[model samples]
Target chain A: MIEVEGLTKFYGAFPAIQELSFNARPGEIVGFLGPNGAGKTTTMRILAGYMPPTSGTARVAGFDVVDQSLEVRRRVGYLPETVPLYPEMSVFEYLTFMGSLRRVPELEDRVDEVLEQVAMLERSESYIGNLSKGLRQRVGLAQALLHKPEVLILDEPTIGLDPAQIIEVRRIIQELGRERTVLLSTHILPEAQQICGRVLIINRGKIVAEDSPGNLQAQLAGAERLVVAAGASCEQLLQLLGGLPGISSVRAGSRDGEVEVATVPGKDLRPLLARTIVEAGVDLMELRTSGLSLEEIFLQLTREENDEQAGG
Target chain B: MRNVWIIASREFRQYFISPIAYALATMLYLILGGIFFINVYFGLETGQITPDGRIVIGAMVTILLFATPAITMRLLADEYRMGTMELLLTAPVRDWELVVGKWLGAFGFMSVVLAVTWVYPLILHRMTSPGIDQGTLVAAYVGLLLMVAAMLAIGVFISALFRSPVAAFFVSLGVMLALWIVGSLASSSGTMGQLAGYLSFVDHYYNNFYLGVLDLGDAVYFLSLTALALFLGAQVVEARRWR
Candidate 1:
């Protein structure tokens, strides 16, 4: 539902984002994963029609973001990094004002629906200044969802929330992702992995990797490790496991009766190794696959990109 | 157009909800009331029952020179300070819509400020023996409204240039003072002096409208000045989108 091609934004002589391109499909929660100053906010602002890109183009729901900004704005909802709000206005008053500005039909009904969706219906009459940070963030979300746009662009939605509030906001985002295309940006690696269906790892204003969280974790590490516990001695199990066709290496695990077996890339040695262990008269207690965490994958990808740039 | 009205109404509502509007309105009425009472008292004591409103109009113009800045300082400056500009600019509304809406809001507030002083004319009508000229009074009030519109437009333009409302207030006050004093500063009769005299807002108001003269030239001058300032203010707002 969103397409950005050769999008470049420059502030004076310095480029904020250079030749960036990405897309978010319908009902897909695409996480823009990057560290601070990675140009994520710049890209989102361009997509939301807040500012035009210095060059190239971005289209949302098939409307040009620059030439057809009003149409693009009509079809997209944006929550800025700072969560822009008027503290003097109450929750319901703020939403009603935003609804009218967005030209939403039946604004009162839509306001109640959005307030309910964010679970903020009870505090609708309270002044925004009287609410906590988490509640204010919910009001921000309510405003974004008021018009029921096809696309939602959120920048650091869970930035300052406590752990529990983060989880709450994440749940709300996940629920919204089920019906609309959500393009959320965050420096928190776990947030991207936990909430986004697909992750776009952006570094230095460029996308270094893009895939599902599981796929990124598995593919970036190249080799898969397995922990096996059995009745046999460590030496005997190591010898037997190393001799298997696809087993690249075998070492004693940290546990008393466990062995760590490394498999070659794109190889499945579990069944063969199991059969060998069974025929050798060893009792197998446990066997499971071990994979790298998303944090490890992200750090490796960003570090590799940085090294490549430095070397080149 | 509907979007403009929506923004305007919201801004207008914001002004009324805050204490600043009430304070400013009360201060203005007291000042106008004091000037009206002193003028009426002195005129009646001198056996001239009809009180000419020129003195009150002169004082009103001088007071609005400072009051216009207070009313308009927060129009755009507060939006920047509070970071609401992001939400406002990112919406589907056009740049002109936001600018015109904000201008109308401040202008509407100034209307209320001007409306309360109508008691001055009413008192004059009731107490004066033969009564003041109704046509000239109406004409003078139109001139005052036009002057307020022009000054408020200039104040809005200045407000757009700064982020702090206090800074916007002081800078606009300085600009208005310069415009007010330009006529007196140019006492000689040369091309430069003539240009300065023509540019002076006080000269235009005192020489033409304060004496009950309804000159179309003066009307067009205030309107053109208002239009010019609003155009510049709109350009400033539009430039922000690019930066």
Candidate 2:
């Protein structure tokens, strides 16, 4: 439903996004993960026809953002990072205004439908400025869904919500994913994993990694390690395990009240380490494999990027 | 055109719901009324105005200077300040539609305030039996509307340049003051003076409408100014999309 090719945005002498290119299929929820100032909002603005890219092109629903901006805008709903709203307008009033601007076929009905979808129907008569942050976010979501656009571009859709509100927002996003194309930008890793069908990890204005959560997790399989606990001094443990059979390498450390040894990636070292400990008259307390979580994988990838930059 | 009307109606409705619009209208009515009655009282005592067309036009022009900014300053600046411009710009509306709709919205709002000035003329009519010519009075109202429309376009154009409504108000005040002073000096200076007079919005308005003569040239001038400013506003918005 959306295609961005060689899209670049330059603000004066600085490049906000350089050659950003991505495609989002119909009914797909693609999470755009990046740190602050990482060009996420810039890309969303271009796609929504609010701003023109400095070079290249972006097309939504087969219409060019620059040349066919009206059609593109009609088909894409955008919720900017700041959630642009008229504070004096009541929730229903604001949505009604937005609906009229969008030329919705049945504006009043659409307003009610969207308000219900965002769980703001009860507070529809309340002014937006009087609402809490969570409720305001819901209203923003409702505005984006007003026209029933083919694609929705949300910048940080769930940034500051309380835990319960965050869950509600996530569920609403998930439901939205089932019907239309969703491209949400968030720095929160769990948000991407929970609500996104595919994830694009962006850093410094470039897409560094793009894959499903499972595929990215699978890539970390071989790097998983088993930390074995043994009764020995730190240096002595490192020396004993360095040349042990079936062991790649060993780095000694301490965990709790005992000395721990980190075995490098290889065959299961628990069985071998247990036998070795008995022969060496050392006590074995624990043998557990360390599973790589999504958070750890994200850190590992980003840290590798830092290492590459340092090397260059 | 449908999109333009939609935006225009919503903006027009906003002016009624917010207190700023009412406050501005009340303040303008009080100021215009104060100036009008004070002049009427003094004119009876000193015989300066004498219920003539000149004093009426002068009083209306003075009212325009103060009242124009109240409506026009918030036209674009308030949207930019509240960040709602992004939402409006991203809609399926055309640039010209947004500009014309906003100009009309603010114009309609100022008209409501200007409508309250009718009481002043009514008071003068009751006091002076067979007082003001209905033709001159009707023409004067038309002139005031056209002048306000033209001034509003300029103010709306300036409003687009800033994100603060106060800045827009002050900029509009400065621009209006320059035009008022420049036009007043034109009649004394010859050909160059005549050229300045042509550029002055009030000169043509007072000569044509206030004098009970509706000149097409003067009417076209105000219309042209309004169209030009609105067109420039649309172009400004379009250009910002690229930046």
Candidate 3:
């Protein structure tokens, strides 16, 4: 439902996004995972027909964002990062105004439907300014869903909400994604892991990694580290485990009953190391594979990119 | 055009929802009324025969210098300041519609101001027994309406360049004053002065509309200026997508 090729946007000489290309299939929820200022907003704006990319092409629902921006806009629903809204306008009034701009037919009925969907029907008449941050965000989402566009490009949809509101918004997003193409940006790894079917990890405007959550971890983990708790002496434990095939290094932990094993990249030595350790007279207390957590992987990807830039 | 009306009506309603429209209308009525009262009072004391309502009508263009900025300063500035410009631009509406719709809304408010000022002439006719020629009122209204339309267009154009409504208001007032004064400045010079005088908004109003003559040239001047201003405003809105 969304296609992009070489999409780059430059604010004067500074390139916000450079030669970036990605796509979201119909009815797929693709998480745009990145930290703040990772060009997520810029890319979403271009896709939503809010702005034209300096170079390259983006199409929404098969309409070119630049050449057929109005058409693309008609088919896309976008919620910006800040959720900028007219505070003086009531929730219903704001939605009606936006729906009318799209020339949506039977506008009031549609407005009510979306308001209910976002769980804001009761407060539809309240002034947007008087509503709390969570309610205002719901109203913002209501406006985006007012016209029932086929594709949703939400930039930080769950931002600035309390914990409960965040879960409610995510549940709503997960439901919405079941029938529409969703490209949502967020810095929260768990948010992406919980809801996004596929994750596109972006850093500094480039797609550093893109895969399913489980697949992404396996790809980045490369080599597995094993933590072993055993009855052997620290030096003896290290020496016993050191000569095993594919064993790169072995280090003793702070306690006498703990040791850690490192292996060659792309190899899982857990089974072989376990068999070797069990055969030996050393009584093993515990043994488990230690893979990098999602948080660590996220940091490592962004941090690695930063280091590469600094080193250059 | 449908989109333009949708946007325009929302803006017009916004004026009433806020206190700006009521305040502006009250201020215009009080200032114009005061000018009329002083004209009659001073004329009676100085032994001047005529307390012309036409002069009071002419003075409106000046008051609108401040009034136009107030009406227009927030039209575009608030959009940028509050970040609603992204919402408006992302909709299916075109750039020209956004600019023209806003200018039309401001013009609608100014028209009501023009209509209310008709009471001044009505008062004059009642007191002086057909004091100012009624036919002249039509020509005067035409001139003032056209001039208001042009000034509002200029104000809309200026508002687009700013995110600060206060800055837009002051700059708009300054630009209107400079344009209003350029005609008097023309008295000092020669050929260029004639051209400069043509740029003055008052000259276009004072020579034709203020005198009760609905000259086609002056009407064209205001119309063309209105078109030019709205065109520039549309261009500014369009430029944002590129920038």
lDDT of each: 0.87, 0.82, 0.88
In angstroms, give how far residue A186 of model 1 lies from its true place: 1.7
Pairs that clash in candidate 3 = none
DockQ (CA atoms), all models: 0.72, 0.78, 0.80
Q: lDDT tens string, model 3, B1-243?
A: 998898889988888877888898888888888988887778668866363567577567777888899999999989999999999999999999999999998888788768989887777766674477877778888888998898899999999989999999999899889889888867868888998778988788887787878888998999999999999999998886788
lDDT by residue (A89-117, candidate 3, tens digit) is 99999999999999889999999999889
DockQ of predicted candidate 2? 0.78
lDDT of 3 at B242: 89
Give the per-residue lDDT digits (tens) of candidate 1, residues B1-243: 988898888888888888878888788778878877777778778967555545467677777888889989999999988878888887899888888888888888778778777777777877865776777777788888998899988998988888999999999999899988888866778888888888888778878777778899889989999989988888998787788
DockQ-derived CAPRI band for the predicted complex in model 1: medium
Expressed as tens digits, the lDDT of each residue in A234-258 for candidate 1 is 9888877877777778899997779
What TM-score does model 2 achieve against the real structure? 0.91
* Model 3 spans with C-alpha error above 4 angstroms: A230-236, A239-249, A253-256, A262-287, B38-51
Those runs of model 2 whose alpha carbons end farther than 4 Å from true positions after fitting are A220-222, A230-247, A254-286, A291-293, A296-312, B39-57, B188-191
Decreasing lDDT order of the candidates: 3, 1, 2
Judge candidate 1 at residue A101 and give its lDDT.
92
Q: Give the Å shift of residue A168 in candidate 1.
A: 3.6
User: What is the Cα-based TM-score of model 3?
Assistant: 0.93
Please give, for residues A114-223, the per-residue lDDT of candidate 2 as tens digits.
98888889999998889998899899999999988899999999977999999999998898889899999998988898889998877667787788877777667555
lDDT of 2: 0.82
Give the TM-score (0 to 1) of chain B in model 1.
0.94
Give model 1's DockQ, 2 decimals: 0.72
